[model samples]
Each structure stands twice: as structure tokens, then as C-alpha cells.
Target: MNDMRMSPNLALNQLVAQRRAAGESLVHLGFGESRLPPFAPLMERLAAGATRNAYGPVAGSPEVRAAVAGYFGRRNIPTGADQIVVAPGSKPLLMALGLVVPGDVILPRPAWNTYAPQARLAGKHPIAVAIPEECGGVPDPAALRESITAARVLGRDPRILILTLPDNPTGTLAPPALIRELCAIAEEEGLLIVSDEIYRDVVHDPATEFLSPAEVAPASTVVVTGLSKSLALGGWRIGAARFPHGPWGEWIRSGVVSVASEVWSTLAAPMQSVAEYAFGEPEDIRERLRASARLHGAVAREVHRITIAAGARCRPPTGAFYVYPDFEPVRAELGKYEVTDSPTLARRMLDLGIVVLAGHLLGDEGEALRFKCATSMLYGETVEEQQLALDAPDPLALAHVRSLLERVEEGFMRLVP
Candidate 1:
């Protein structure tokens, strides 16, 4: 079990730090952190509530829960405060969900590494289903049904399906029609759906429609969302989960609450205060989120263009800050330099002073020669610089970020040429 759990991004980060410490000119594209600073008013709200020192309820305070419910309400999901469970981070909340949910975990191949491990940790088997070409999180509906039948034939109980709307490594959004189809299957098979919508707010197109599973299949769906991606508030550690409305929903929710009491106990009072403020539909907060999405969308598009031009195949990112580039087109050139596998490609990129996670780490085939590059790390070093860039008339042309872009473009070119 210990051998099964590993974090490729963390390993890549360590290598990046090592190379930089040795005075290597490293271009870091590893960790996916929002380069923007926290909204000024959000920080002020947290500071004002700094004295909230007591441990709050296991689910969260009523105000915070109500705010989260209202947050989803604005998005057309009819949720209430009772359905909201706030935790330190979506990771733990997801782990708790895994623990409470029964049956084998259904994971899309090439997913965030933790999904499989969380299932294994919760004492369930993780069955991987290959995702369709269009998206990285949810398996193709036909493929999913096939896998479910295959698993059951092999005496496995594949009953829980986890999906990422705007996937992490691939940075692609699952289309609404595909989501509706998957929901239909989940309904037929009696499978629990865990939709990780952490990156939904950072989606590139304002006109792109997103269909939440809760909207499509409210009876057995649990939507997991948090401020880690959208708010650049990872350190704040605020996450929320919305459970369905049914007897089984209460059972699963109770199991998660019980686990929370024994594990994390409760979310921090100050962070809960932050969540209360951020989740409420305030105009200032909405504007801040809008600016952030614009910046992220612009930068991600630029990075995607550079990678594509460098002779790699990458789906144009629709959300999040990732570009999963398959270097198969340049495999001959890569092999000439002894870079034959994904790990070698990752190491070679690091040697060239560009830090990116190997696709193999995210469950892609080792020989695939693919990697996930996080473009968000291109932002400026200082909080003041981040804030200025966030408000700049031309955010994409910010000096520091453009410099990082030049570095990435040069690095990829060097790799293939």
C-alpha cells in the first residue's frame, strides 16, 4: 500500500529545487498554484475574523455552510446549508468521501494521482477506465459501461465514479452532453458520482456551458469544490462538498462527518470566516474571480500555442493551468538523446532547466513521452506584482510572466530540435 502511493508533482518540485539550488537556470512549470494574490477585501475579511479561535462544528459553521449553499445556488444548483460540508482542503474531504462510499472506485486513467491512492487508502479497489480523447477526467460513456461490465464479470464491485470537470493534468473540460450521458449511466447502474469541480470557475470561455452532475443526477452525486484553484487561496485550506438529497445521501454524509470528527475534527475558524465571505455572492468577489479567469485563460492559451508549435500534440486547454503535451511526434529526435520514456523526458526537461511532471506520473503509459506543464507558475514572484498583473489592462504581457513564457518556448524547442 505504501509503495502504491506516490506524488509525481512533489518529486518534480524537489528536482526543480535541487537544480535551482545548484544555480541551474530552471524554468518551473510543475506545481499548479494561482500566480494571483488573494483579493484585498477577502484578506481584510480574514484579518477581521482572526480572533475566531474556537474549533467550529465538524461540518462547519451555519453561516459558512449557508454561504457555500448560496454559492452553488447562484450557479443553478438548488442546494441548502444542510447539504454543505466544509473542510480544511478538498483533498481530505475527497478522502472522506472515498471512505464513506462503498464499492470499488472508478477512476479515469491519466487522472490526478491521488484519486487512485485515495481509493486504495479507503480499502477499496480502484478500477481505471480510459478517458475519451476529448476529456481527461470522465471515461467515455461507452468505455465506462464496458469497463463496469468487465469489472463485475471479474467479481469486482465498481460502484463509485470520480470525475474532474476541468481536469488537472490535461486541463480539458468535459462537454455537457457527455456529462449528461455519464449521469444517465450512473443512474442506471446505481453508481455514486463524485464530481470534482475545483477548476470550474477558472474555465476559459464565459460562453462555455457547464452541466454539474448535481443538476443532472442529484440523487447520487456529490460535487466537490474549493478555493484552492480559483482564489489562489491554497494555503487557506477551505473546501466544500455538496451531498445529494436521499436516505443514502444522509448515510454517506454521516459517515463523512464521523470520519471528519476523528481525522481533521473541523475546519479552522478563521478559514471558515474566509469561506463565509468568499462564498457569498458579493460583487467585489465576483469581479476578482472574473479577472483571475481572464488572466489564467490568456496565459494557458499562450502556453498551449507554444507547446503545439514545438511539435508536440496538446489539446487546447479550456480550464485550469495545465497543458499535457504528447511528444510522440518528436520521439525519434528525443530517442537520439537517450530520452525514450516519460521519466527520461521529465528528467531531460529538468536538465534543460524546465520543471514539468511526467505523464507517467499521472498514470499515462511510461513509454508515451508525455508530460503535464503547469503554466500558472509563470507569474511574478512578489504579491504586489501579482496583484498589479491581476488588474493590469493587458495582463498577458506582464514582464515577468512573458519572460517565463519565453523560457518555456525556448525549452520545448530545445527538446525537439
Candidate 2:
């Protein structure tokens, strides 16, 4: 507990900022920050709510919770105000779940970095199960059952299973069939599933189908999401969660509120105002969401093309602004650069003026030659430039965006060659 390193993505973002401040020009492909500016309506709502200063309920203001409940209701998940909890960010809600949920946690092998750390903070073992070959987020059904049995055999209690929809590090959504299969396994094993759907609204294609674990195994699944990734509200720190509707869900919700009372007290008043309006998903807000998704998908696909052309086996970006490219194919050629594993490979990229989060930082094997490239950071350095990209019919056609993509391409070409 005394010596765990800071989350790698945040650390790398700070490092890149410091280096850029010192006049070093580098392509930043490390952080998943949506480079878009906030919609005027969201900021207006925050300002309007500024006069309300008193602390509210431990869960959230009833109004905001109702709005969030409606947000889920429209998505076909019947949610109630009592089942919603607003927090500073979904990260803390997830951590609180970790603290409250009993037994060890199960996680995808290369999952969002925080899941494993949060589980450890809760004094539980994090069992790593391999993800399916076709997509990330959900653990492979067969591997999950085996992992659970093996952990129990070894005297570890595997209880909670955390999943990511449109997973971080690898921006691919798990197919509906696969999600159902995994949900069935959870039902059979009585595992509590925490589905992290932060990137749900950022799907590249409007026609892409998404299936929530809650829709399948509603009795035991808790869905968590935040405005940070989808609505570009990272600094404002607005997040919400929908608990299953039952006594079991209520018990977990109660424990979380207790944790929240001791920790956050309540979501900030101004943020509640913002969350209420944002989670309502009004017509104007929906348009903004669609535009943002288009921009993310455009830039990410270009980056994917660059990675693929550079001879790396990269997945096509489907939901988020990321591509997890495995460099194992070029390991032999990379020996000259002293790049043998994730860290060394990432170090070589940074040395060559590009920043990438090594796969190991996301809990992949340290020896695996892989890394994550966040395509979102390629948007631009300034508000005006980002807005231009957002409004453009073809974001990559814009010079500022194209130049950054070119830099990534050049960087990868040099690394692979």
C-alpha cells in the first residue's frame, strides 16, 4: 500500500505536459482525454446551480437521480432514483463497490488499470482472466469458469467481476453474444458483475449494437459510467451508477452510500445540476454527443490505419478513441533498439518523441511486446483547433489533425523499420 505507483496514464499525461512546456514537440498518444470543449449548455447549467451550496443526500439529489434514472430508462434499463448514486467521478464509485463487495475480484487480463488497484485497496485478490480473442472488456467464458475454480482451489475467494464496455486501452466493444455468454457464466457462479460503460456513447458507428450485462443479468450486475470519457467533463467530475433493482442491489447501494458518506459526502451541488441536465440527454446534448463520437471515431480510425500500415496487428477502432497494437510481430527487428518488452518499447517511443502507454501498465504481461495508443490526444493543443476538428465533415482532412496523424504514422514507421 505504501509503494504502489501512480496510475500510468495520468503519470504519462503529466510527463508529456511537462516536456511540452519545456519546448519539446512530441506526439502524445498516451492519454484518453477527449480534446473537445464543453458544450455551452453544460457550463450554463453549472453556473445556474452555483447558488446551491448546502450538502445534499449521500446518494445524490433526488432530482439528479431521477434524471439519471430516466437516462437509463430510455436505454431500456428500468432504473429508480433510489438505485442511483452520483459521485465525483465513476472511479470512486467503482472503488467504493470494491470496498463493499465481499470476496476477491475477477478482472480481464488487460483491463482498465484502476480495477486491479481498487480491488487490492479493498483487501481482495484480483483474479486475471483472459479476454476473448475477438474483443476486449468481457472475460472469455471458458477461461472465466476455469479461473474461478482455480482461484477457489487455491483458497482465494473470487467474488466480483469487473468489465469494461468499449474497453480502455483496447477500444473494442464486446459483441452481444459474447456478453450474454459471460453473463450466463456469472449467473451460474453467483458473481457480482460491475460493468464499466464509460465509453458506451462513444461508439464509432451509429449502427453498432451494444448489450449491457445489466440487461441480461439484471439481478446481479451494477452498471457504472461517467461524463469524463463521453461528455468531455473530466475536470467537472460528474459520474453516475445504476444498481440492480432488488434487495441485493439495495444492500450494495446502502453499503456504497455509507462509504460515500465517509468519503465524498455528496456530489458537489453545481455538478449535480450539470449531471441532471447532461444525463437527461436532451436533443441539443444528443447532437453534441453524436458530433463528438464522429470526431473520435474519425481520428481513431485514421490512427488504426497508420498502425496497420506500419505492420502492427492492430484492431479496428469500433467504440472508443484507442487502438491496442501488439508489436510482437516485429520483436526480432526491434532487438537492435533494445526493445524486448512493453516498458522498453514504450521507452523507445518516448525517446523518439512519441508517447505511448506500455501494455504492461494496463496489466498485460511485462514481457509482452504490446502497447496502447490513445488517438483522442491527436485532436489539437488549443480549444479553437479542437472545435474546428469537431465541426469539420472530415476531421482528418483538417491540417492540424492531419499533421498529428502524420506524426504518429512517421513515428510508427521509424519504430517498425
Candidate 3:
């Protein structure tokens, strides 16, 4: 416990701020925060709820819960307000899942940095399985079965499986076929699935088939999402979850609310107001999400191009705003700078005025020369500049945004030559 460091992304953001405050020209690609400005109507809603300050229901306000229910219902998952539970943020809901769910946890290797740590804090062992090559967020179907067997062999009760949709760090969505395959495995193993779909609304391509494990295995899967990413409301801390409608689901929900009662008590009143409006999928909110998705896809693709051109192997980001570039192809060249591993590679980039979270911190092998580059942070250093980038006809072509992109490209170039 004493050995654990702060969450890598948060810790990196702090480091970047400290460096910049001391006058370093740091290009922050470390944090996963969406740098977009908050929607105006949402702000009005927050203000409207400001005077209604009182502790709400432990699960959530009925209006907000219903809105979240509809949010899932529209996605083909039949949900009800009774099945929904809201929390300060999806992070707390996830940690509560870790605490209430029985057995050790199974995670996709190189997953969001918080998952394993949450599991440990919940007093559960975390079993990491490598992701499939085609995408991230879900474990390699083949590897998962073996890992489960190995865990049980070691007397570990492997019962809970956590998955990300449009995964963090990698920014890729698992295909529907893969989701179905993994769901089948979960059913076979009798494992409860905790699906973190926080980025589901941020998918770069709307036409791209996105499948949620809850849809495929509703009986065993619990779905969680929040307004943080799509609406850029991270600070508002509005998150909600949909449990399967049954005795088991009710049991899980009750247990989570119990944990919530002891921990966060309830989602703040004002944020719940924000969540109600956002989850209702109002027309303005829908349009804002579409535009934000376009911006994230565009900048992420550009960074992917730069990384590939710089001799790193990177998956084309299909969703979210991240690209996990593996620098293994340039091992020999990087060796010249003694960048033989992920930590060294990260340090090398930082020395060149670029900040990225080392892959190892997200559960990748330390020996791998890889790091997670968050393109969202490249929008701008100020809210006004970010709004301009968001509104530009061609954001990447905007002078300020272009200059930032150039800085990123220049940083990558330094890595190779």
C-alpha cells in the first residue's frame, strides 16, 4: 500500500503543471482529460440547482436516475430508474464495484491505471490478461480462459471481470464479435462483468459497431457511464450505473448504495441536475457530443500519423482521444539514447518537452518501449483557445492548434533522430 504512487495520469498532470509554472515549455500529452469547455445549458442547469442544496437519495435523484435509464434504454439496453445508481463520478462507482463484488478481479492488461489499484484497495487480487491485437478494453478471449484457470489453480477466486469500451490509454473500441466472444466466456466461467463505458459517447465513428457487454450478457453485466468525457464535466463529478434487473442486480445495487452511504453519501445536488440534463440526450447536448467526437477523432488521428511516421507502431485510434504508441520498432535507434524501456522512453520524451504516461504505469510491461499519448491536451493551454479549436471549421488547420500539433510532431521526431 505504501508503495503505490498516485494515479499516473493525475500525477503526470501535476508534474506538468509544476514544470510549466517553473517556465518549462512542456507539451502535455499525459492526462486523459477532455480539454473542451463545458456546455452552456448545462452550466445554467447547475446554477438553477445551486440553491436546492440538500442530501439526495443514496442511489440518486429520481429525475436524474430516470434520465440515465433512458440513456441506456435508447442504446438497446432495457433499463429502469430503479436499476440506476448515481455517484460522484464513475471512478467511485467502479471502486465500489470492486469492494462489493466477490472474488479476485480480472483486468485487461494495459488498462486504465485506476482499475488494478481500485481492486487492491478493495482487498481483491487483480488478474491482468493481455488485450487482443484488434482492439483494447476487453481481454484477449483466448488468454482470458487460461488466466482464469491459472488464478483458480493458485486458489484465487476469480469472479469479477472489468472491461472498458473505447478504452483509456489505447482509445480503441472492441469489436462486437469480440464482445460477444468475451461475453460467452464470462457466462461459461460464471463471472460477473463490470463494464466501464465512460467513453461510449465519445466513439470517433458513429457508424462503427459498438457493443456493450451489458447488451450481450445483461444477466451478468453491470454498465457504468458518466458525463465527464462527452460533456467535459469532469469537475462536476456526475456518474451513473445501470444494474441488471433481478435479485442479483438488486443485491449488487444495495451493496453499492451501502458503500456509497458510508463513502460519498450521494452525488452532489447540483451535479445531479447536470446529469439529468445531459443524460436525457437533449438535442443541444447531442450536437455538442457529435462535434466533440469529431474533434477528438481528428486530433487523435493526426497524432497517430505522426507516431507512425516517427517509426513507432501505433494502432489507428478508433475512439476516444488516445494513442498507445509502441516504440519497439525503433529499439535500436532509441538504444542510442539509452531508452531501452517504457520508463526510459517516457523520460526521454519529457526531456524533449513532451509529457506522456509510460505504458508500464497502465500495466504494460516495463521492458516495452511504449507510452499513452493523450491528444485531447493538445487543443490549447487556455479555455478560450480550446473553444476556438472546438469551433474551427478545420481544427487541425487553426494556427494555434497547428502549432501545438507541430510541437508534438517535433517531439516525436526527436525520439527517432
RMSD to native for every prediction?
1.4, 1.0, 0.9
For each candidate in the order shown, give its overall lDDT on alpha carbons.
0.87, 0.90, 0.92
How well does candidate 1 match the true structure in TM-score terms?
Answer: 0.97
lDDT of 3 by residue, 325-417 (tens): 998898999999999999999999999999999999999999999899989998887889999988877899988999999999998998888
TM-score of every model versus the real structure: 0.97, 0.98, 0.99
Best by lDDT: 3
Stretches off by above 4 angstroms in model 2 are: 1-3
Tens digit of lDDT per residue, candidate 2, span 1-417? Answer: 532878878888889999999999998888878878998999999999999999999899999999999988887798989999999999999999999989999999788888888888888898988888888887889999999999999999988988899988789999999989889999998899999999999998989999999999999999999899888989999888899999999999999999999999999999999999999999999999899999999888888888788778876889888899888788888988899999999999998788999988888899988888888888888999999988999998999988888888888899978
Ranking by TM-score: 3, 2, 1
Candidate 1, superposed: residue stretches over 4 Å from native: 1-6
Worst lDDT run of 10 residues, candidate 2, spans: 1-10
